[model samples]
Target: MIRALALAVALACPGTALAQAGLDALDRRSELLGWEAVGRLDMPHGTCTATLIAADVVLTAAHCLHGLDADAPVRFRAGLSHGRAVSERQLAGWVMPERYRTDRGALERTESVGLDVALGRLDAPISTTDADPFLVLTDEARGDALSVVSYGRGRLDAPSRQGTCRIRQRFTHEVLGFDCDVTFGSSGAPVFARQGRRMRILSVVSAGDGVRAFGPRVAGRIAPLQAALDRDVPAPASTTGIKRLRVGEGRAGASGARFVRPERSP
Candidate 1:
């Protein structure tokens, strides 16, 4: 059997300290991950992390919205380095698969193995100030070495009100494997990598125990989702009014690699 190991790339906070921590930890694995905006869905139970896939779009776990109906207000926070952010965004709409429900047993099995994905369209294009350049996605046939990042209260709270992540696991794609260091609040962090000059996102961290487990698999199923994102979803015009940022001078080489510089506001 093809032993596929799913990698869970975590989301990050966007302050000087968080950025520095990410940069420091990223130097060795820069090609595998980048800084992303992960927000919680805000429910009585808990919260979930989210990542930006498009200009005004975020990709999170469907379970995050499972408890609420379609009309529920979906709030999001980017740059999650400090305990929270003052400049978070509120979404206009939240969409997920119709099959999902707020039940217990179904949620557990469906969360890790099923298509537990969700999408949110922001009220406007999220400012680059809070979010940053986009990350890429990995194909099914690619190798299985991933890096996860997160900003939340860990077992010890080393970062202190900032984001912290560790190398969770290492396995193949056809069969997934993980170290299970992630927890409930860590859900929705993007799993990605950089091949040559492209930042390819493979899977989003869904769920696992506190020890060692696999992340949600994302190989053959992502095609339809990618199609939906590219063809069906619409994004607002850029604040800069340009297709892409120039990043003219001070910014490092554009190898689609994740780098750390002074944080800026949108």
Candidate 2:
């Protein structure tokens, strides 16, 4: 499931050193503007990135919650850095595209990429904190550069911010291909485009196949998902059993997390 295109381009670029250097760890909560809203979602199966889009609403990948126990607990650690987090909240509920399926084969389809978005409600609101939720951009990114902040396997202790990355291609109205550097634990990470002093979320990291990481574009999927979340639609029940695997196991590092279809009961 690992792709080498983005890696190869990252390595071949003369600015690779500078780009790597720009991926600074958000160790200090006050160092960046939007770092506080982005956090790590720790699941029983694994970890993935998450961002607060509203005081009580979090945006992440639908697949991140797939296969989890119906009553399994999830922790949202905001602005986590070096074992310290600015805020922590329990997930109350979540909503996803009605068309999303947890089966391994279905999740691998290109169409599934757009449907892989989800919105989670936090048990408590964090509006009082310095962390502010980001606005979703309805317009497509026409800018030359975008930014991403995420936590991955090797960099699990703190969130890292890639100050700038390019959109390699806009595969469709729903699917976006980016050259952003990401890995296991980076799913659900936000891809942002700056507007003046503020930044808007353009997409959430979903998966990477070869050299490009892709996600559901904000305009097409997120808008509808947000509407569903606002209307209190229940998330589709997970039909598959959790496929827990050891860290560094097969395809585990392909994205932020990976799951296999469980055998059915006789």
Candidate 3:
């Protein structure tokens, strides 16, 4: 079943072949059991990766939904592989820290890391059997070897796993730097730490500035955010939408990943 799904994905998304070869594909339900909650968010503006930290809540990067109408629609496809998925849900509301600003200049500042995180509330609760939500690791994640599974550009058909990335720097208590391989559409992807048989979410992929990837540490921010989300009601609609520039259409640094698509023969 897993191989069939993988073959289906490979055929549907021919562009992902080269990149997929280097990363492990969570092709079967069994292979995806640990990460079934991690999925892709298809926003009106663009696509960003996301993960379920709670059955009704999703964690992603604030910038992924920045500067759009507050009433836009964002669809979450859980455990998406090829044309199949474990489940799907439409978000009802979302919240980002007040400190996380989306102004063009904000990305350059170190303080921006503190505001990069965001949480979305689902309209309905998802079944645990489809995908189990991950627990947030409250401790600082310095010098730890981590893994990232993301639905990046080109490889959007299925999630790809980079099972052995490392945290190279801890900029502050709130921010950590990693040597993970990420690209456009990878924004909001979870950086995970495997503990025994369980996987815990440590941080979220925020930016890949061509050198290293940066994610907001989950240490102190998660509890409060989770509390706020619990009390917060669903918004009438989502007003924000992401505007994405296609590869080679403009300079790529601002968008996150600078990936080169393979050439095709007619």
Pick the TM-score winner.
3
The global Cα lDDT (0 to 1) of model 3 is 0.68
| Alpha carbon lDDT of each predicted model | 0.46, 0.68, 0.68
Ranking by TM-score: 3, 2, 1
lDDT of 3 by residue, 1-266 (tens): 22322232222111111233346767766667667888999998788889987667889887777675667999999999997889898888787776564453444344465567888887776665566677776665555558888998777898888777788766643677777877777788899875544457888887654446777786567667766766785423332331221111322344322121221222
Clashing pairs in 2: 3-210, 5-211, 6-211, 185-256
Each candidate's root-mean-square deviation in Å?
Answer: 8.8, 14.0, 14.2
- C-alpha TM-scores of all predictions: 0.61, 0.75, 0.76
**What is the C-alpha lDDT profile of model 1 across 65-134, one tens digit per residue?**
6667555677766544434452366666666554543443353343333556667766666655455645
Show the lowest summed lDDT stretch of 10 residues, model 3.
Answer: 9-18
C-alpha RMSD (angstroms) for model 2: 14.0
Winner on lDDT (1 vs 2)? 2
Q: Identify the superior model by lDDT, candidate 1 or candidate 3.
A: 3
Candidate 1 TM-score, true structure as reference? 0.61
